[model samples]
Target: MSINRSVENMAKGGMSMEEFKAWVRENIDADEDGKITKDELADIIRRNGEWFAGWKARKWMRSADSNRNGVVDEIEIGNLAEFVQKHFGIKIIS
Candidate 1:
């Protein structure tokens, strides 16, 4: 399924943290790798808002990349719903 379809499904009832992380990877992982880079994250944030894309992406990476590998991996993604709520101002219950 496409990312749009997955997001639509999430809006209907929400999905698990793992599912949400997969959705994020599918949408943002331009290199098709298992990890997401800071640029990819910044691009997503830029698409969402006009201000502080760099700062927000760095902050997100710092918070989400638990292993400090300079990228966010599937295992490192925790409570993505909470991240969305804090950053995009959209509350997700999953």
Candidate 2:
């Protein structure tokens, strides 16, 4: 789906936390590497029309990359929902 459409879905509270995570994996993982990188995270934030996307992405990476692997994998992805909701203003229904 287009980033705009994904953003619209999120803004409409049409996704649960699990669905949001899947959305990020599907739509935001630019490289399709099964992991979310800092750049990808920043891009998603920017797509959402947020200011300081880069900085916010960095903060989120720090908070969510539990192993400090420099990327968020499936295990770490769950940590991002709260940050996404809080920082990106994306509503997570569950």
Candidate 3:
């Protein structure tokens, strides 16, 4: 495996949804539902997107926590975001 991918995978071993999503973004570009295909995965990694640039880009994608239970929305987006920010320093902007 490539160095970046190896590191990303290593980080993912203990990832939550937020962290997974962030890793996905830098390492993945998933669609609205957070599902990724093999082709898309290849395309994303090939582009050389780091696991996290730590940039506070402007965006406010709907929370993956769809249930509104005040906890990950019963999804992985928040968790993934947290991980990305914490490990890679990629800031999440609203």
Candidate 4:
């Protein structure tokens, strides 16, 4: 199931962009993969703001480790569109 980008990112809940980024990074960077890639971003978004409990705990841990650098950093994480095109095997909307 897909998750609401805003829902998972609701931690910011009226905070500033910096705070929002931090919250998103904290949750999105679950594997500590420095940047939040498409797959990594997807999983975090997939959590659907549910806290990602259950079997997904260990399964999606390394789900977004596209770089294999052992961490998903912001600099490494590309835009959502770019990531979706490359990792999701879908046609980019340009």
Tell me which of candidates 2 and 4 scores higher on TM-score.
2
The pairs that clash in candidate 1 are none
Clashing residue pairs in all predictions, respectively, total: 0, 0, 13, 9
Compared with the true structure, all predictions reach lDDT values of 0.67, 0.77, 0.44, 0.47
Q: Over the full model, what C-alpha lDDT does candidate 1 score relative to the true structure?
A: 0.67
Question: What does the lDDT read for residue 30 in candidate 1?
Answer: 84
For residues 1-94, write the lDDT of model 3, one tens digit per residue. Answer: 2225544555543545455555566555545344533444445445555343222121112223344343232245565365445546545542
**Candidate 2: tens digits of C-alpha lDDT, residues 5-84:** 55666567457767776677677899988888999988987887878888978988998899998999888777877666
How would you encode candidate 4's per-residue C-alpha lDDT over 57-92 as one tens digit per residue? 333335534556544456433343344334433333
Which scores higher on lDDT, 1 or 3?
1
**Prediction 4 global C-alpha lDDT:** 0.47
Off by over 4 Å in 2: 1-5, 11-14, 88-94
After superposition of all CA atoms, the RMSD between model 2 and the true structure is 3.9
The TM-score that candidate 4 achieves is 0.38
lDDT (tens digit, per residue) of candidate 1 on 6-65: 365565555666677677877888888888888987887676555787887787787788
Which parts of model 1 have CA positions greater than 4 angstroms off?
Answer: 1-9, 79-82, 85-94
| Displacement of the residue 25 alpha carbon in candidate 2, Å | 2.1
Among residues 3 or more apart in sequence or in different chains, the pairs in candidate 2 whose N, CA or C atoms overlap within 3 Å are none
Span of ten consecutive residues with least summed lDDT in model 4: 85-94
